[model samples]
Target: MESFLETFRNLDTSQKILYVFGGAAVTAVSLVAIRILTLKEEKRKDYPRDKVILHQIGRGPFAPSMTPFAVKLETYLRMARIPYQSQGASFNIFLWTIRRHNKKQTWNQGHGRHTEEEIVEMMNKDIQSLSDFVGRKRFLMGDEPSEADCSVFGMLSQTYWQFYGSGYENLIKDRYPNLASYCERMKDAFWPDWDQCITHGGTREATK
Candidate 1:
């Protein structure tokens, strides 16, 4: 008998078409038969992929930013190579509470001026601290992003993008433009779904 390859090569076009299709059908049938004989049919169980919940720290009017703790958690998750789902919320309640306390003069009387000045001074100090930390690098840490950058970016994004907040008066833009730009860069890096992260409470998958 001719070798299988030689016999196939010698077949006419019509015969070859029939042979190819017939062989495919036979192979499919054989596979189904073997599967039926050897494989047991088990009910499929759906299990979600293991993932952590990423909690966003600060919530602005149109966007949700991270807190220092949230940033650290995010960095750790990235380093560990684990999947995560995020949820964003705001601190307006807490912020309003603080303002309420301030207005009541609970701390030092309802002296908005004094409080404003003190807050500005504190912000100035924060800017200086970041300036010292960043020096002449892309981020607070260096060329590579670190946990600290995440925290700093979250904080600065609030100051830069969030104008509704009490102290978010373009301070980052006026003073630390570098840091403002850096926040943008980091946002591009970490949060690819920028608008979605903000709109759907920071949880991209949850939106769907």
Candidate 2:
């Protein structure tokens, strides 16, 4: 264990990042495999033809979503003009527990490897990269929004809206005004009824 720790500590920052993410990838794939092998297949739901049902994490009274991938997939569906209904709290509890465990393990590994400042610097670098890439462009890839926009916007929404009072909000709102503007454009275009979607966003009906 001592030798292993020493070796890990000796690795460069990029290598450490790669190792952490690679482990996460493996963990995700293993979870999927286990689920396929052990879980009984449910009878498929009958949706109207051409309609899709998205089982995302339940919406909070706060942010659009607590999970980025859920937001990403939903945003992609919207951008593609596909019809879908959002359902939440429908996932297997066992899988959810496993995910939480994996999250802790990943967090521990990352923080153990780097200082808080180092982590923040890395994150800010990523934000800057995104800002540089999207400078003055109406969308990520220029005039029209695409699938890529959905993915980026989903992740950015966390820093912009969800992680309030955490200084990450400033990363978007202050440090990178272009990214902030891009998020606003995406929200304005894709999620016009965003206010109604949240639990306390009034009794107004949320857009499907």
| TM-score of each prediction | 0.54, 0.69
**Where is model 2 more than 4 Å wrong at Cα?**
1-46, 90-103, 107-112, 200-208
Worst 10 residues of 1 by lDDT: 14-23
Q: Quote the RMSD, in angstroms, for model 1.
A: 27.4
Candidate 1 whole-model C-alpha lDDT, 0 to 1:
0.47
lDDT of each model, Cα atoms only? 0.47, 0.61
Q: How far off is residue 185 in model 1, in Å?
A: 1.7
- Local accuracy of candidate 1 as per-residue lDDT tens digits, 1-102: 332223334533323222221223322333344344333431242324687755442333333432234444564566456888654433433233222332
